[model samples]
Target: MIVIFQYLSIILLIFLPMPHYLRESYLASSMLYSLVCSNSMKSLIQYYYDQ
Candidate 1:
């Protein structure tokens, strides 16, 4: 989807000049945080629907 592509592009831009290890760590943490945020948003929408 567009959102995923945007996320990847942003990551690529940020890491393009960094060392390999730093890039890997940045990507790993960004992915984890995005996953958590997406899940939280999903739960919030579900809660609203259940109300």
Candidate 2:
């Protein structure tokens, strides 16, 4: 939970200073990174189970 909050705060800090046009792109990239990390963690757990 603390790690998630840290990421959210970091994202907010980055977006707060950007122009409206760039905010959407930054948010989309952040979402993509989060998704990739979640998927990778899921796969790692599955691999451990399969071992």
Name model 2 segments beyond 4 Å from true.
Answer: 1-7, 10-17
Query: What do the candidate models score in CA lDDT, each in turn?
Result: 0.79, 0.77
- Give, for candidate 1, the lowest lDDT window spanning 10 residues: 1-10
Per candidate, the number of residue pairs that clash is 0, 0
Give TM-scores for every candidate, taking all chains together and pairing residue i with residue i.
Answer: 0.70, 0.70
lDDT (C-alpha) at residue 32 in model 1: 79
lDDT of 2: 0.77
State in Å the error of residue 33, model 1.
Answer: 1.0
Tens-place lDDT per residue, model 1, 1-51, is 646875786778675798879877877877777788889989999999999
